[model samples]
Target: MSDDLLKRTRAVLPSWLAIYYDEPIEIERGEGRHVWTADGTRYLDFFGGILTTMTAHALPEVTKAVAEQAGKIIHSSTLYLNRPMVELAELIAGVSEIPDPKVFLTTSGTEANDAALLLASSLRRSNQVLALRNSYHGRSFSTIAITGNRSWSPTSLSPFQTYYVHGGQRYRSPFAGLSDGEFIAACVADLREVLDQSGGDVAAFIAEPIQGVGGFTHGPDGLLGAFAEVLRERGILMIADEVQTGWGRTGEHFWGWQHHGFVPDIVTFAKGVGNGLSMGGVIARAEIMDSLGANSISTFGGSPLTAAGALANLRYLLEHDLQANAARQGPVLFEGLRKVGSPIVGDVRGKGLMIGVELVRPGSTDARSADAARGGGPGEPAPEIAAAVLEATKRRGLLVGKGGLHGNVLRIAPPLTLTADEAAEGLAALVAALEECTP
Candidate 1:
């Protein structure tokens, strides 16, 4: 059944659409922490479609809201007064963390980011933008222009003059050997150098608190906080791309930017907030959000159905304290991986439910065995091994995810509603997969 569907998908879908594993399995339905394939085989879902199925699959609150709203009305455009839209905007503004914030709803993360870019550039009156190296923004033309990953960026043509900066992901950074303070200083100096060389008319510095599609990678907690200070003095706006890092996905911080101790001028979000409904938004300080008096409205941006459903999801997430659940379950899964303790696992890092284990080719420089673990050549990215492990994990009734600039990181982001038992089960499968697949 999957094979037939895959054939049909390739025949009709765009060539660039990516599928997972050796054979792509169709997810027919989902429960708390699992999904059943078209053939009725269940797999423990770890990635949650790149962290979109945030709370849980088929959450009753969200489903009920959607069904009830749809029966009354779906979309009535933005022309008339929409109570649900206004109510949701009010809720988001209260939690946005920006002082005097205003919200604009969109249909996707790409659109939210596109709006942010346009807002910043229009206010600053410059096309020069700063983005962190190894960051993945979005696939649209404008967002792709700012994305630092060459693999995900499909085109060279861009509307903005984008400059790539360091310190987004520090594991493979040039300052890998430096201490945290030194690394922050070095990255700050680099940002200054870029501004100096570019003649200093930069519009904004946009970055992800955790680079998502680039893999679940980030520098030290205070890295962005330091950068924000430097940019603030220069009158440069900061945009936090919180599409993946928002909604308390990163444990210990309600927003990923909070881990760094600073609030961004603009924050863009999608995925998870809607709990699979097509909804996204940008929140900005009113002064910046209203910079241009040019009136604009998104026809289907805050439709009644998506708004009602997303509101229910948000309420359920907060009332049930899903963020606290993520904080509790995250460490359990990480400890399990540590006990796996395979040489193929280079690093296990992330917060809350979002985690990643970078893979390296086994026997690379023998840093751990006969030779000492110091001053050895870094292991090459083992993408082939990652692919093998994905297949192995899938066969064991576990569905994790693979990513990274070099395609060597296994990204694990289960629903925030994951239980301790489910975490143990997923980790057990992951360890077995590693043991069977590691060379």
Candidate 2:
């Protein structure tokens, strides 16, 4: 039956699109952090659907809310008020520090970001948006224009020439080993150059609180705050693209940028905003959002089902105190990985549950010989090591994801529901995978 299903899917789907893995598994069901294949194989999901399943899959409360909402109504155009939408907005505002926040719902992070970008650019009457080189905003035209990753922004050149600024990421910092102040100064200098070079055309300086796809990496301490200060000075609105890092994933606060002591003019969240349901939004300072009142809106945005799921997911995360749990378990997992002490483990960096393990050519091994044997040409970024590690982990019934421009970093972002014992199990599997993949 499973083979027949796979054959049917293969026959129906287009072959030109890239598959995520060399071999893809036919996942049948999920609960908590585990997923079962159609053939009865269970795999522990460390990536959590790319960190979208914050509350984990098949959460009873969220499922019940979604079902109940389905019975009532699915969607009402933004032109009319919906009960669940209002309640969801209130719930989000209650958790945020922003007073009198206004919410604009969308179906995905990309649309949310696109809406934010349009608002920011329109309000400031500026065409340039400054973003970090390693950061990801989303894939739509306006959002992708601001996204810094080349993989997503793949044309030889952007038609609109979307401007960007640099941020302080210490792992591969432009100015490594600098003090926090020095690093921030460098980042600010880059922003200044971009702004000046663009003849002050910059409207907003946008960034992720901590870069999620860029190896689950943390930015320099106080770097975001410093950038905010610079933006304030230059009249550039600060936007936090917290789509991946928000909602207590960082543990210190509900919003990822809160730990930095800075508030964004516009904050967008998706991914786990609805705990795996299709929902996203931009929470803005009331004044900023109001400025764009008539300029933008979504047809199916703020649907009752999405709102219900979001409210339930938010409540569940808050009620269970999962943020604090992420904080506690993050260090435990980090310490265990560090103790394993493989030479291939070049760096481990993150906050809370969002972690990145950077793999490099181990100093103890002959890098050239290893690359030759692994079929990776010289200076090919060593993502082959990451791939081998992932394959080995999967063999042991564990799953994880790779990130970084080079795909050489292992990203560990399990559901917020992760337990200490479960973390230990996942970490053990990772360690074993590393040992197996090391030269």
Candidate 3:
């Protein structure tokens, strides 16, 4: 059944756009942490659709809310006020630490980020913005501009971003030789330089509390606290891109920025907010959001249907204690990977469920043998070990995903509903895959 479906998909879909994997399984449905192909084969899904389905696939409450809202109204123009939209705003405010959080809803993370950039620029009356290197905001023009990835080719990048700092690569940080306090001081000094050199032209400084796409690197508490202070002193808005790290995925904290011990002027969120429904948002401190004079708006930004789905998802997450589950399971999963002791595993770091295991080339016999224990390479592994692990896991009734600037990091983000037994199973599969690809 899966083969037949795959054949049909290939025949109908554009070949150039299709990313063909070795095993072309046609996924038909999903429930909890499991996804089934048309052939009825089950695969434990640790990827969670790249952290977009936190409450798990087809959650009853979310599905019911979406169904009921569809029956009522699929969409209503934002020109008119909508009840779900209003209620969702209230829900967001309750969870947010911002005094009077004002929400600007969007259909996806990119839109939320775009809105954030616009809000920052308008609020500060400046075009210069500072961003951290190796961050992934979104694929929109403005968001991409602020994104510091070297691979990004954002069209029309203003000649004017003040200076992008590199953050969260503590092992090889730009401030590697400095003490924690000195490192914090260095980061703050750099930003102060940028702001001073640009003569306070920066409107905002955007960063991810935890660098999700950059291999789940968590920011040091003092670093973030000091950076926030610098931006605050300069009167620049701080935009925290919590698209991947927010909405209970991080476990211990509801908001990733809260982990840093400061509140952002604007926090952009998406991914898990609607449990796979198309909903994203920006929560701003009241004064920051009110800076604009009501001329800025999105047509489908706050549809009643999407808002209803968000509301239900939020309730389900809190009531079911999914955040607590993420917090609980996250440590277990990390320890399990650590015990694998695969030499190839250079780093195993993340908070909550969002995690990554970096693969680098071995240097010495000890390093090689250590990686040999887990099956990793020194430089870019000749055969793409991570890709092999992805396929091997898929073949063994599990689904996983990969990411990183070099696409070598194994991204292990599962639904908050994932059980300890399920996580153990995933870790076993990962270890087995690592062994299978041992170079």
Top candidate, metric lDDT: 1
True lDDT of residue 347, candidate 3: 69
**What global local distance difference test value does model 2 have?**
0.81
- Local accuracy of candidate 1 as per-residue lDDT tens digits, 50-89: 8889999999999999999999999998888898889899
Could you list the CA RMSD of all candidates, in the order they appear?
Answer: 2.5, 4.0, 4.1
Model 2 per-residue lDDT tens digits across residues 198-247: 88767887788888777776667678888888788878888888889988
For model 3, state the Cα shift of residue 198 in Å: 2.7
Q: Give the winner by TM-score.
A: 1
lDDT by residue (tens digit), candidate 3, 224-328: 767888788778788888999887788889988877778888999998897778889899988888888667557787788888888998998888888899988
Q: Model 1: which residue pairs collide?
A: none
What lDDT does the true structure give each of the candidates?
0.89, 0.81, 0.78
Better of 2 and 3 by TM-score: 2
